[model samples]
Target: MTALSEYERLEAIGLWRADPQAQRRDVILSLGDASLVISDAKAGSALAHWSLPAMIRCNPGERPAIYAPSDEPGETVELDDEVMIAAIEKVHTIIESHRPHPGRLRSFLIGGVVLCVGAVALFWLPGALVDHAARITPQAKRVEIGRKLLTELSKMAGQPCTSPSGDQALAALSKRLPGHDTIVVLPEALMGARLLPGKLAVIGRNAIEGPDTPEVVAGYLIATEDAAAGQSPLKRMLGDLGPSAALRLLTTGNLPDSGITTYAEQLLRQEPTPPPTDGLLRAFRSAGVSSTPFAYALDPTGETVLGLIEADPFKGQPSPRPVLADAQWVALQDICTGR
Candidate 1:
């Protein structure tokens, strides 16, 4: 149920009733991750969440179509927004298309033994399904999922640091980098830099504060991107959450909040593995930044990361230009300090 890009976060006005006998009330209907959210128009408080898969159009092909969740017969909502109705119908059709057809059952059963053998070779059925889901998942859905993870992680990591000057400096720094990701500096709890989906990266306070040159932080960002080349952060998250989470996302276009919270808790304690040396050096070369600073940052003695030092792309020479201006660097360093 990966929703269409145009319909992401779509909303419309509607009338809702808690039950058959209840009076209809004005509500705002919003397209949630995999459900329709009914909220009080005046108070803006969420009243109910109706699963899209279970949604039933009671008066199909009629104006101000009446709808209800199959699970809750008495509750109903009335919506006349043609765009919203079309979006929901499209999602429902996609879900239905994925379901097994009774007519194909015989053919499916005929290949059951072969499928079982292939599944045994793969060692897990969900792995294939998860991979397929990850491949087909659109950018919009990835951003939505990443935003949800960040919301959960913020509870443990603390709110992201922001200030007028610092935010502008961060924006400039992103433009200087290769990926131009939305870089967030957290007050505390993150170690180095971690890249999330949707071209977002989060770094610990030290990345900006400890480095004398912005190249150091830029190197960390580049390294994180290269690290994700092997396995995307989104796919890694789904795999960690287990098969059911992936299945839910494919069928319902949403991951269970309980699973997300649990995964966020685990992510807080886990350390990021360093990117490969060759790949990291290549990334540095591509970004026109020297790796010496980052290598020394990892090991001050430079004994362990000697290759990064000697193979520095800009060794014995200045970078093509400064990674950041003197003033911008100062602003970024004090981002958490609110200076």
Candidate 2:
């Protein structure tokens, strides 16, 4: 309070009593910005700081005024300094003039708090809840969700090709591939490959049946994994499912069947775009596979996919290991034939 600056350094002598039964002692009373400071006269050590506004004159309209803190009436101060008394009264007047109405301020603060809460519920809760749910979901649960999504996707993509030998061959390929544990071959409605939740990858039948070398199909699988960049597929699915379904899944541990069907339809409509060239090359290097075959498969002339061809990790060098055995490759090619 700028008005208080005039009396800020003002001091007075007063008699102070700690409580009703204590002896009155000489004290130095000093004016503070918003308080009255009391100190021991002999030691000059602080005794108390009383709020200027809460100072009450116990006996008003008399000489040698007796005053006490509003909260503690037993503790009192006896002062005869007219200048200090007048300064304190002036400060009280200034404070009262600047004070807002208690009722109005309380109402305003309550309303602001309520609006903040409502905003959080409307805008922030859904995305945060979805993120939390995605982080905590177990691997087993993710696999279950992926299977359920595959069931819906199968309606459009066609059921996965399953022959005794083909299934075993696919399992071997899955083991050979890094990042994902399962590789599902569909007869149609898939171009290159798609990585799903729970380290599952879905590929078209042509990837195996049409290619001469297993490296081509392996490259496609690696490309899909690179495209995903280690993101949780369940999080992507939940994003498409929206907040309501995400909340339901969080509470019930299951997504809505209708939501899953809708997401599958959306997934089928979207084409899988290739990951960045640099990242694809890195994935190829890490997998110890050549990118030449996959590059050629994307563009037979090798014109459009020249970067991948030129940066092939196995260029002018033999691969560290074969992606699959000759027998496994042959069996995988016959997967759709059910032979």
Candidate 3:
């Protein structure tokens, strides 16, 4: 909007109607959480949505659609009302005039300098950091971190995980793993699975027991382990440790083991953010798992993951892994659906 010239501002809002949807021509404006969502109120669905924060109206209202400089064209709406048109223009002017405080600008510059320094260090001495991490983040510590993450995961899931099917599903998954050890599926915190040092993988009950084939569960488990391979889970633990403890992890290969529990509690209450993409891909491929199930879990659209779908290595390979042995599979399926 700030980029819009006075004329473009007038065009940004107006009646936008598509062919075959003429009856639903609507006066639209895009706003709301992280989307430039155009509501075709009469059509009963969003006409178009552009992911937000990075989007801006580039050409104003040249057409019923405008795109950001770096984004694709997004659907626009009709705002022919003289009053609304004038208001949008005024708003744009106000926005352009509002500048950050000098203090804030100084802070931003200082922060940017620090970020550059850190980035250089991260790249210049990456080996040192990774080596230091390896020393500080031992297997035993990762296992402890995994446990802490689970406690928080359960809380975020918003319900107790006592379903017999969920329990049975987890138990079945445990049987097919790389290690011969017992695993307890608890509630989720940061993600779906936690690989303990002893080859024990902890899963959230919802993960394995969802409306998915066994492949989905395997894909997630492998991905989590791959994440483990890159760094010790203590980075995650240090995430909850605040700055002082993070410095400790950086300088010394140790943190107070007691800090692990707080992370676990946070996991139960909320989810951790997603992992880096390269790490995700490595984990998925190493585990003999397809990207299809995980993609679907993130989004159900067949088109969103069309590439994964086309390259589905499992296509015509063989049937998916059963959730359990014949008897166990049947029992586990009925665990949630009811007998």
Q: Can you tell me which runs of candidate 1 are displaced by over 4 Å? A: 1-118, 121-124
Looking at model 1, the pairs that clash are none
Instruction: Give one clash count per candidate, in the order shown.
Output: 0, 0, 16
The candidate that wins on lDDT is: 2
> Which pairs clash in model 2?
none
For residues 71-130, could you state the per-residue lDDT of candidate 3 as single tens digits?
A: 444334444455544444454456645755798889999999999999887665555544
Model 3 worst lDDT run, 10 consecutive residues: 2-11
* Order by TM-score, highest first: 2, 1, 3
- Each prediction's RMSD over C-alphas, in Å, is 28.9, 11.3, 27.1
**lDDT ranking of the models:** 2, 1, 3
Q: Give the per-residue lDDT digits (tens) of candidate 1, residues 46-155.
A: 99988888898888799998999885568899999999999989988998898879878877886897889887757767787778777777888888887888888788
Q: Candidates' lDDT values, in order?
A: 0.84, 0.85, 0.53
TM-score of 1: 0.63
- lDDT for model 1: 0.84
Q: For residues 15-105, write the lDDT of model 2, one tens digit per residue.
A: 9999989999999999987788999999999999988888888877887988888856578999999999888778877777788899988
